[model samples]
Target chain A: MDERQLKRLLTEIAHEEIPDDMNVWHEIRQQVETANSRTTRRGFRLVRTGLLAALFVLATAVAYAVYQGLIGSDPGLDAVNQANLVTTIEETQELGGDYDWAVTLHYAYADANRITVGYTVTGAAPARDQLRPFTNTLLRDSTGRQYTWLPVGGGGGGGGGGSSDPDALVPFEDNIGASFDASIIDDAPESLDLTLTIQLAYATEDARQEFGPDVMLPAGDVTFEFTVPFIAGHRYDGPQTASASAIDMTLQDVVVAPSLTRLDLCFAAPPSDNGKPWAAFADVTVDGNVVVEDFQLLSPIVPVADSDCQQYVMPLSLVEYVESGEWTLTIAALRAPDTESPDTVIQRMRDEAGINITPLEDGGYMFSEPLPEDMTAASAALADILSEEQQTLEGPWVFQWRFE
Target chain B: MASLVERYQVHAARVAYLITQDRSQAEDVVQAAFLRAYRSIDGFDPRRPFQPWFMRIVVNQALQTVQRDRRELSLDGDRQAGDPSFMLHDPGPTLESIAEQTELKQQVRQALKALAPEERAAVVMRYYLDFTEREIAAALERPAGTVKWRLHEARKQLRTLLGETEAEEG
Candidate 1:
């Protein structure tokens, strides 16, 4: 067939396959409205905070005490509270049915970049090989923009079994408490009127086992609407420059929020005669306490839009409230990716570490078996090589800022 | 925004469906792409046409979803069960012309199934979306030369899969 005929045929197939009635604007609108509401409420809160602070202090304290249970055992939420950045969300809903299920929205913390919400699900565990409780959450602001929950570790959802069996049912806990973190893409408002919708459905283990279509329980959605005032943070936009190992680096922006700290650093690209990719790494400390953990030096290196220098945004999650004191970001080293190919890396791991690594089709490597306890160090070294941290230029190029 | 969705949803969904070969997933990819476009509208330059930027998001999201589904399938160790080509839309109406059209669609679907997702995307953009090679490159974030190569390879594969020789250019 000619190009024209193929085009006509493809168009016809598409038109026939996708009906004209298919529209997803309703879903889009739901998410958009939630996001917009947060912006509006944040503006409103900023305008009213000065006038209402004195009158609301006592009432807010009492509410805080009542809602303190919701933030149970989450280090991040506890840090937000310690930083005085948390807003209590004392709302609960009952799923009124055969199963006495209840959901509570405990508390929320929002900074300029991220929002974290703690919640709890109190219900009976599902009977083995029967129905299982499935909880889906949708978070939105007053205006209707939805925020996707950040996956903790590699997977999303609060709790699930790690069994490899297809028929293995995840044993549900009576009181399942979890926290959801979502990064705000747009500029976060000073105050947000957030609405979180939690829908509960009981899914069967398998359709083939049940010999029928999957069933959805009659339990409806439980929604909690609350206002969370963002904890004030500091932003340093002045150019802070330091040079080490003949490489000049500048700290363009540093935003220290209750939720997280973000650093924007610009540096001159190291000479690459061999066409190898290089990246920068930093060690951040607040009052002599190291704040950055598991700093992945490679991946996500973006070039500054209007400048020759490359920029990287490093987000650090503080486990504890950062006290008002000295803060330092030391550009410790510049590292380049390993010059060897994937095959070479795999071969080296097998030869030196005696670890069999399989390269997946998606450009990732997997261990053939779980590493022995003694092999963890070797595995870490292998990871560094795979991540391309071969050559290194060491420097303690430091940039300091005071938060008071 | 509604008007924009109305104008682009069918084509965007069609491209996503053609690439992913799953109706429900295509719908989801289109919705997510529209939401992303809406959220990032402030970053968009007004002087440029919106279609390419929006289409780029749809294509990228579709590609990511396909990759993620593949990863999940690999982890689950049941690769054959969730193959998406089997989940193409229902057959068309029973009239003579409609039956012929349905047969043609089946042939096209089978032919498309032979190409990789990236090749399918390139072909859809080039033929159905009428995107130029440069435009396709910009949308896919690949070099123009790479886009040309993909299109050439995809057309050759499709010709072989569909069992038809190229006719003279109009």
Candidate 2:
């Protein structure tokens, strides 16, 4: 078209006016103004500072984030202390008896909050020949600055033990630890230097002479004054050796009827070569008499030779399987078929010769299986097995749960 | 509302002058831009150098105003209607050519108004103001690609507008 017209149009386009009103700009500017004015960690935006300054600022922000990242692992877990553990134990002993003993154990499994303790009281330990099942009243308590608890119950267990005779011979293997809870005196005068005195209210002189002075009473009550360093943390793991109880039964005989079942363990070498039994023989004593005089652990419980006789058959020993690197570790508790008593039968046996015959509840024992003589050689083997296989007991449970 | 006097009016005026052909409208656009700038001061980054930033704001402000007022922006509109000389062209030197040239100046004013705000802004900043692509981006708070595309598009639109005007006169 006309070049003259194009030039004129271009000239006209150049002169346009801007209006005066629109204002929200001031508010937006102020938001950024404060951050810019301070001598902030974020340095000044240089005059054409280039990409370098911006990159540096970004780097600094990332570095600070990384440093804080590595340092926050145990923020709230460190709050648990020794005092809270002790106070918890001291608060729950003897149903407020004037001379009650409170024992609190503060242990950590991942430093989590709360610890539980269960305590049981039974009539008495059964004598060696008599299969009197031990009666247990279990109570549990939580360990903390404050002690909370559940009431006592008679029957329930991870496992239980019993016998045919009224006097059931109790062994350390059958022994159940202090219950999860205890009935304690809230106002009992506490002892920093505490002495927990336990007396046998109605135990025979024979039992007292055999176990401890605490066995002298009608019913033996073992009062444990957890030594000043008696700190109980972690759950009560039912390993006889793993958990140690300090008792003041010095003059009195000390018999711990913990229904412990020793595993059938053997050295890779023969008994003669290792100069030891497959397992050490342990004297299973009840109220006062030894129930299992001394039994040798021949082998770990494996498949039954005849599953047909499962009703009354003994179990294979865990000792044998452990030595062989394999064995069935099933521990079942069954109540006595004859009597409706709380006692159950727990058999630890293998398909092979060695069978560990023990009761799980408060009654009934099959008298057909005779007791073995000084199986001390087996005890020696068991001691080694304990050293090698102790970690096994650190898990699950070796004791019975107290069901109402 | 307190008489929006721009703290950076001078720089804004310079920006308007560089982009616009009419000095009078440049002054007016700059003032409007300053009023907008003054109102937006609170939103401004005080840490930044105020001049370039304010220039960017003024350019956008003026472009928008031009787009909104087309009659005030053009050349031929001002000449009286029905006057044959005002409408026609003389192939030689004549009173109509002189009047038409004055009308051309007026047309320039109007053409600015005719442009879409963004194109007017690009043409104003790119050619009239001679600002580099990077500076225009900062002013528009846009990427360089966006600024370049806008400038290209504005130039094409202006060329077409100019072509139409030439065709009308011929």
Candidate 3:
């Protein structure tokens, strides 16, 4: 008989006989009844004893909490981060004081090799440096402006905190477009020592006092450590096996559809890393125009100090979706001190952002098509949730590109 | 005032039957399940019906055991629960031959494992113990329509697993 018939027969549930082995339940029942009988015989005495015992326990617990709270037991994530205190505070409960913030890290989201740290500041100006793995440092001001500490000829080999050349810290884009999908997260251990410093404080009156990132604390540079949860796909030990060969940007397969709007972008990371593992992030574009860019990704999901870090492979984002296209993802090459050469970055970006999104009449994206007519009931029930979301967007779009 | 174990005794075998797919595993699962049931009986609602609630706990524990064992099988809703369908259809050599005797039954057991977790559960509750679909849905915290769909898919998959034709699966 087929599995269906077989399962039909097996779904029949039946009860069990009392085991001849051990009757733990039987003994437990007897013990409970004995306890109950004892209570009935000396009811008042038993109640008084129980109440006294409970009070003693509650008093002990409250005393312990009071001691801890006085010594600043567990500071909030914000306070610990701002204080930058490496050691636990015994006198003050605020972990991160007004200047430096430190925290007990629990997880990381980067691949094992590159530590990714995220931090915000109270004031806009401060001096910052990563302690180990590399001593990379930078400076920022009250307006959230970032400066790259360029060591004349320093960005060599081990990178970041490695070089100690004549320094000329130049103004760099303080905020890079970093979009990550933590929709599917898992536990992967890693961390970054986040240090945010706001300098140039004496220049403005408000800068002297009102400068926390997003109006939180006050004005000034603050350094702290915040932990991030890991994303499963990015974790790797040493290197990646080139599961898919790297694509040459010059010969990228371009699909041209004219009427498409709304594009869904994703990155396919190389399974592992070799330092040569091509997990690079970049800005995406169509026809020489920038639709999306700055994909900074940290692998393995989270990063903690004194532990390994995750690398940012290809950071993918929806480049600007129109209804259709004969679109060319103009691979822009970057000439930077902290990124891969532009051409290679573009090629890596294209491979990960597989251009196989379904262009539809509603301009919204669907990961699947109606199951081929061959499989069993292909019922509309399967289409339930997807069709529900599709009904929201108004108007229709067309696609000139024959998606073959 | 009655002990918890005594109250759920009648449904024990039925609960074990659906979960382990084997009388031995089912028996063990039920006994352990009851011990756990007793330890946490304070949480029991005095107002609700006990059978479905007990079955949910028993079935959940059984399914977890199966998962731990990595048993792959199917969930079929059509097979008549009480009938010994295997013995009637596949009569082979020696009744002494494990293959001829219990093989078909075991295959039936394993086939049941292939169904999606919920669908298999549905089939077990509905056909095996003859609980209605509504009761199965309530036990699972799922809607009746979703339950029907899961059952339909499970049955379809099982038909393929069991080598049944269109009429049997449909």
Candidate 4:
């Protein structure tokens, strides 16, 4: 209640410690040693390239062959990422090092616009709901130009799409497909060199249950560099229209390729909207069969030409299309964020959270009620208000595009 | 360096744990902070104390994680492990006293949870870690006025929450 009491309580909280042998000290030591050794090895490789060139050549050949066999020589586009099998380049390389994990590049799809690589990692169980934990990927060409990844709206986008089910796959196995935007390079050559470096760690069983962000089993860093050949594809531009409850959007262009299907959408909404311009396309039916079966999002609202409305450049999974059949895009919802007054937001919070928000002189609101005995109930109340603001604008906007 | 980690791991881990409320996350933050500090040990002034400097890194890492995930503070006992007081206290205590202490701890934690991450960090630095406002501003890379404002706002909320508790008691 008073200053002294508050200090004592906080100090007590600060001093709390978990009782266990799970201290990460040993792990840290191992990581430090590994890093030091890697630095030494890199130094040797750079300085003694000529001297070890022959030996390195022989070792690389053997390592590559062994690695290809470990994961399987033919990595067909299976359940991981439905990359088109016709245009996929299945190249398997073994990132041989001191890594406790094994990674095999199953297949890759590359074009002038984008590059998507599918790979499977065998190691300790991965963190649930997390993809590409400490993974760094770069695509480069002979010109020494590097391509960065475009924003993937989902949580930890570079890891591609997967089920959020915590028990979906065994912890030791993670199948991930990463898509990178190559739009930065004007005319990408027929092929580009991709260097994917990932740092992963095993999560302890307890850490898995608690889902601690920092909890790691051990430090495992590996780099895979391989050439990905691109395949050319056709582009379709249309002024297709879709509407739902005062929300309307046009499909300006769709670039269909083996690697990724990119759709450029020009969206138009009312002026008094605060949310990001997003249409939740629940499914896309091609030839009377639904092509898009998963819940994919295109958000973080990239703006179009200097307008209150925005443009969404959505890159979707590969799908089969018929030149004469009908195509229907089923939009589940059009999401526009809340742009209401602070009072309105507070009223909504009160209505949902049942908590009182009092305005401070500094123009900030504070929760004034007795702290809810049920913390979950209190957070749930606040979370409801937070979520409500995100989905302020909603509608099912369906659009159709026909090909002759 | 090993000795330094051994000596400061508990304190650094506790600081991170209080802010993030995840035991494994706290350990990770502490490890990262120590590694960062270790990498720049030459730049550190040996004349100055290391607790605040090291703790500043711990707080930053924890704040970054919270911002990235937007995780809410929880008062759930199972969510977090370790009771620093448990180590310092005698195992035997009057059952009623233990219960009362736990209830009070929970109430205080709940009230603290309501504060934003920055405000919570300010309170912890000032009252929990005993950092002066200027020192906290320096550690957090903010002006002294900002630290004071955060503390003032945090204390007001804490007062209101605890005042309501007192009224219930009366």
Candidate 5:
């Protein structure tokens, strides 16, 4: 194709049919008005200090109630609390003014490697279907070094027990709790002063689905300042080697922290015909109990820098930690990503499992019938194909470490 | 200010979409770029064309967003494998002319995805936005020679990826 043709094609690609009702200017005006109102109300705080104190006390009580509710719900935080690593913060700060939002910092856990903070928001909630409240967080150290904070796991909304149906529209509640995680300071300082700034905002259903930025509520940004003493973890550095199926593997290190366990491993596998990268998955056990229930879902295997190695960081439950005991990490299997195209995979499913999948207009497939509760036959067939497509070298490459 | 947003919002969003490959993320990038431009408008020279100055912010924002997403994905690891129930299926045939155009666009998109983000930016600025090499260099804050080299390499890669032979230079 000539440059003219390329230009035409690209120009066509660039042609986006923007909706007529997308009034970005209106949103911007709303933000500007909110900012101006906040500025004007900044001076009225001194006169309301006594009232603010009363609210603070009430908020503290509410926060304790919320904390109690969260204890048995979140296993990770429960484990951290059981390990005596959680620092409780019961103070409440009001977003104040027209936006009657109150935020309470419930608890925090920090180590040299990671940090987790939990908080609850209480106020007038937006409509469930139209709008949702979201907390945009920024974490910075005393030196003003900002770290990228992300949601620890999927469920961000809490407090209301909604329906199990995916199609159900759950109502928004006045109180909700959320937890955020970030990789904290690497160098272990005795203690570090940190500030977490959370901006409470509302997002329309469209915006949320589009991943658009949230519209800042009229309330000002809430800041929580706390000092977190760095908790250190036990690290075992080794060149431990094990071999199976003519492949040699090495365990570089293992780090056992209050929040999670990390394993650094290196190995070389024979080149596959499809040329996809190989990944090593392992089963971890602490005192004869399996630490990870599903190796494929929760464990994140990250590639080590400048080496043919992968580092797996598995989150620990309360039962996985022992004050003084042995931890065994057994490499169970090696697998590669599916190299087959989606159409091919679907065809194979139809031919082998007798599952007819219909293509939807949105490029997704729908099963001809509701899937059976027991998928043993379908799963077994897929597993057979998967084993055939990817070479799996099975080995009980075990590395044991005892920590006190 | 409203006029400026109205005039440039579609173009900016489209360019961002080409770079980020996500409609919502592209819109977010455009919104942020416009906000940034509004805050920094005092620094912009009145004599200069606003399109290039504004587009520079859009390109940079898109690139930064892409980079940040890559970092997050690396940390998060690959998402769960596609469930058979929701797997993507092949698009069937359509009207001949429309199908040809759709196929061509899909091929171009795949080729663009294969290129580096920076390379994609250079191509979008040069061919899609019709920015001259000097204009692109000024917008990107790079040397003219570097801009030319980037455009050259990007074009060569696109050509090879698209399975097209040498074409006349613009």
Candidate 6:
């Protein structure tokens, strides 16, 4: 009835007896029994029916092959493969903003899941120096959805170290070539009507001087609205179901292409019109070896129309495979948050303890907090707060399947 | 690994169940948390205590589970099945005392739910697990000031939810 009694009761309840049926050791044992033995292969089959896939590619390439020939071999357009290109939308358009920066839309490669756009930027010396667009640098489609662009040859280098006056003239003429993801235009028909817009982003003077910032300030945006016509890539529909933790998820289709390899899955989740579900396939092993280290598996879920089932696209990796190989994917493992900040917490603790904190690269702050300086006092302090906080898991919800 | 699961399964499940208030989801969260913890165990320093570290994962997993299932979650911690207070029985002739205690526990759970997930974790870690403010700050991977702020804000919200004062409860 009082605060003290209430606290006691709550603690009692928190420590309340768990049900005997609630023991998960058996399930855990089964899951961790053997990495390979635990998984039963589903729909074991070879990819693309082998010879037919090659034929389909060759057949599809017939019409576009001529267009590819017409565009010819421009070294600037080498970021995207000539074969992967579905359409050649070689139209040059100029921005009507403060500065003259022309962006030429070359071609577009689109699958059921992803679309990558190829473009080249040509501008005056000041324009080239002032503007640098990174991924999500431009918003596309009629909805103004954001698309991050990763440049070809990793060049978004509008890097200048000095912080000068806004009106300072730095004259240079250059052709900065890059490619941006136009994938934000989610549902792509045979043709895509895209409105690509890039706004001028200003970098701080302090950041420029100290960290050698890659971004510069000034200028209005260039908006280009054009229709990019392309043929839809291949999609293989195979209904396969896997269940874990009482949730049934079905692999409805798989889209294999040079641009992206995607798995289309459907599962029952509460209807959410906004934001994708946090379902991810973890510890993905392709033929017993762990690959795709740089690229994280993305599960972008959209609500299935008029149903409790929501559909999601699980992008396996950026690595494209010509043949479908046996792949093992795991779900139900919660990913850890960025632990770099925890190091900062430790550093702050060290600062409190009168120990110096040093900075490390990749957002790591080094410190041995909670350790006393002298041995006589160190024993007592060491008995408390051991300065390490890394933990791991037994395993994850795994699903093994093959393409035939 | 088996021993680790056997040792903390009950506690982890309890923490997850309390946070999610859904038995099935709590079990899934605990399972996922254990899996995550096991996978990342190589990074774990052997010197640190495992309970708080593992509990942090449990709490985070539970919060994420709740978030993903947000549409199904009710305003009062997903109590769609039945009120837990009804399950409580008076052990002695003090029927009124048992009822009051149950009512208070229910109020506490409701009040705890009103706070943000991080704040809820802070309150539970402080009161239920009997962790010091500094220990909680470490476990939650937050600054001591942040943990202190969350606790203060949680207590205020709880006080307001429990009808303004200790005098009223008494």
- Fnat of each candidate: 0.32, 0.03, 0.10, 0.17, 0.17, 0.18
What is candidate 1's local distance difference test score? 0.57
- Ordered by TM-score, highest first, the candidates read 5, 1, 4, 6, 3, 2
State the lDDT of candidate 4 residue by residue for B14-72, as single tens digits: 77777776677888877777655643332243334667667877787777765555534
What TM-scores do the predictions have? 0.40, 0.23, 0.26, 0.37, 0.43, 0.35
lDDT of 5 at A350: 82
Which run of 10 residues does model 2 chain A get worst, by summed lDDT? A248-257
lDDT by residue for model 6 over A183-259, one digit each (tens)? 34445466666775544433344546765654445455556667755444344566767776455767666554444
- Looking at candidate 4 chain A, the ten consecutive residues that score lowest on lDDT are A65-74
Q: Compared with the true structure, what per-residue lDDT tens digits does model 2 show for residues A237-263?
A: 222311112211111111111111222
What does candidate 3's lDDT look like per residue over A310-339, in tens digits? Answer: 222222212124333333332222111112
lDDT per residue for candidate 6 within B14-109, as digits (tens), equals 778667766788788777776666433423443346787788778777877877776776544532322444224222222234436446666666
Tens digits of lDDT, candidate 2, B16-117: 654543456566766555444432332233334556655666776666555566666455243221335432432233223444554455534454545555
Which RMSD values do the candidates have, in order? 19.1, 37.2, 27.2, 18.3, 22.2, 24.8
Q: Judged by DockQ, which candidate is best?
A: 1
Clash-forming residue pairs, model 4:
A15-B84, A16-B84, A17-B82, A17-B84, A18-B82, A125-A171, A202-A217, A275-A337
DockQ of candidate 6 against the true complex = 0.07
Tell me how each candidate scores on DockQ against the true complex.
Answer: 0.13, 0.02, 0.06, 0.09, 0.07, 0.07
Give the per-residue lDDT of model 4 (tens digit) for A291-399. 6642333432223457533333344434347354677766665433333355765787678667755433322233432223343344445434543554444556566
> Higher lDDT: candidate 2 or 3?
3
Ranking by lDDT: 1, 5, 4, 6, 3, 2
